[model samples]
Target: MAVPAPSAPAATASFTNAGPAGFWQRAAAWSLDAALVAPFAGWLAWPWIAAPAQAWLDQVRALLQHTGQTMGAAIIDGASLPRLAITLLHDPALHQATAAIRSATWAMVWPALLACALLGAIYHVAGECSPWQASPGKRLLGLHAADRRGRRLGTGRALARYSAGALSWATLNLGHLMATAAPEHLALHDRCSDTRVRAARTGLPRWARAWLVLLAIAGLVASAWLAQAAGTVMQAALERALFWPG
Candidate 1:
């Protein structure tokens, strides 16, 4: 009786309170984030990305002029630029010239990639560590990220999460698919960082959610495609610049 009386207050059991986001929610959030930040990344990398391509185009133009290829020389002379481009695209000489350009440009890709990676890391880490506890995209979608104990991530943890997320995107996105297979819907990056994405209570209807997700995905894809197309056009323009000073 005395021992029992002396016993301290009973310890309270604790349980994990994380709300773990599902695949669709995470995908929607990522799509939104990419839409918002990818352009900035491309802009940051533009100078580095274009330099080698420009140089290669210039070299190709000079060679084409020297070799006396009618279409290539005309392309450089600003004579019916679009028509010449179409002709060159079918020209075997054009293929060889651009092949050299393509090879040279490959090495230059690293700078653009590095710039984009850095921007993306900062964007994700900053958003996750903020008081909002999510990127703007995730917040808009009523989702948040947290640790196993339902705590907001610290900056260090956020950085680690972003770094691991890069791996999740690599390897055919098998790491991301792990979320679908996990009991708690934890992705490989989340597991590696001991974090999870949680959905907050929201009043939006189902249709709105679907539309939002779709819009975000479409925007991200369109932005990426446009960036790539712009780069291609820039390289072609550099070739034309050799003939037309403008």
Candidate 2:
């Protein structure tokens, strides 16, 4: 049988024409992506495996503490600040938190890796748009993908745009959260991906229809800041919880 060509994604944008994606739009897109991938990944691997993961991290933290004591001892013996700082790098107590972080992080490796791979596949294969033409989340928001000028981004531009997320996400996903707020509505990833997201002109509710577009933009900035803060909080919490291990 002849292979059927791929079709445009079936869109789920209930509020198309609601205007440009607000922070909520981007947020919804990501939520959709999580919805798409989380069920299988979490159901199959998370709950049952969490205990082992936590236990392993705990042991790693203890080892880090032991190592910290050894380093502290060495520093006292040498009476050297310079050596202490350098040697303290190996300090076990100091690293208990770090090791716990490392261990906890390891636990998420599988799921995060799978999510990233799946996200990439979903994005790259989308329509004739560039790899960055439309993120999987954007498509689900009933948003259309285009460059600022409303042109379809070609292959080369798309790859760069897609690659930008590696950077955008580096700052705790501020890259993505910041995009919806840009006057141009271009995220760091969007510039790299050769794509922009606009509200689809369909079935727009009146309230959303007349809402000031800039409000969405401001919301995006606020939300991105909040999201970044949340990441910092989680990291600190992980450090404290895992501190005893070292």
Candidate 3:
């Protein structure tokens, strides 16, 4: 007996949103990802930041080492106080300086992290559409980042994804490269946010996929060169969200 063929699902009458991101879709997204996300990560992780933290640690250590000398001495303005009071609060000047420096360092650290999160979210959210983000690479390649339902992501969802993304990036210095190959064009962030990057066109020709792959390679080369010239460069979230192989 011949089996009856299953009925095909009817296309939505209204204009429906795009769908899950494909491998090439992600590749297209990567074009801009290189320029934005990569560098921001570098700024905070830069050696300059580490130096300040290290200096502050030394300052604390010195305060502890000198405390024994002034066990319980008190000071009167510029005059020396009892040894006990001095020990109680030795090197107040250095301590204050150290505190100020530490505070400044932290000021940069937390904000830099948040800013990275913000920028990453913006890229994923903004660049899922055509003419996305206006980056040369994205324009040339015709790629964008979209949510699973083929709708553009919202700021709230994007932010949530960004936060999760930070963890993934922290672990791997960017979101997992495994996502694209896993199934959809979504890294950990997109998965958590229920978003994805997908191809705009269906059944794309092999040539287009090849172009995407080449573009991805070129983008990587350029980004690496830029990172080398500077200190470091974090891949742009949009590009990573789109083109990065998962």
lDDT of 1 by residue, 1-246 (tens): 445532211210111333566777777677778777878877887887687778766755554553344544565656796776677668776677767767767756777778778988888888888766788878877777878876778899999998998788886899998877645888889889998887764234485478776787978999999767655655565555555544
Q: What C-alpha lDDT do the candidate models reach, one value each?
A: 0.71, 0.58, 0.52
Sort every candidate by TM-score, greatest first: 1, 2, 3
Superposed model 1: Cα runs more than 4 Å off: 1-18, 52-105, 201-246
- Misplaced by over 4 Å in model 3 are 1-28, 36-115, 122-140, 173-175, 201-246
* Local accuracy of candidate 2 as per-residue lDDT tens digits, 1-246: 997754433232332333555555655655556556666666556665577577765665455444445544554466577776776676556666666666666765666566555556455535426333455655645565566565656656555665666788788878877765746566667766666767664333444333435456768999998767655554554454455323
Q: What's the C-alpha lDDT at position 189 in model 1?
A: 90
Q: Estimate each model's TM-score.
A: 0.59, 0.49, 0.40
Candidate 2 positional error at 100, Å: 4.5
lDDT (tens digit, per residue) of candidate 3 on 48-149: 566666765555444443342222222222335564455455567647756765776685476556656566556554543323422244434444444555
Candidate 1: give its CA RMSD in angstroms.
10.1
RMSD per model, one decimal: 10.1, 10.6, 17.2
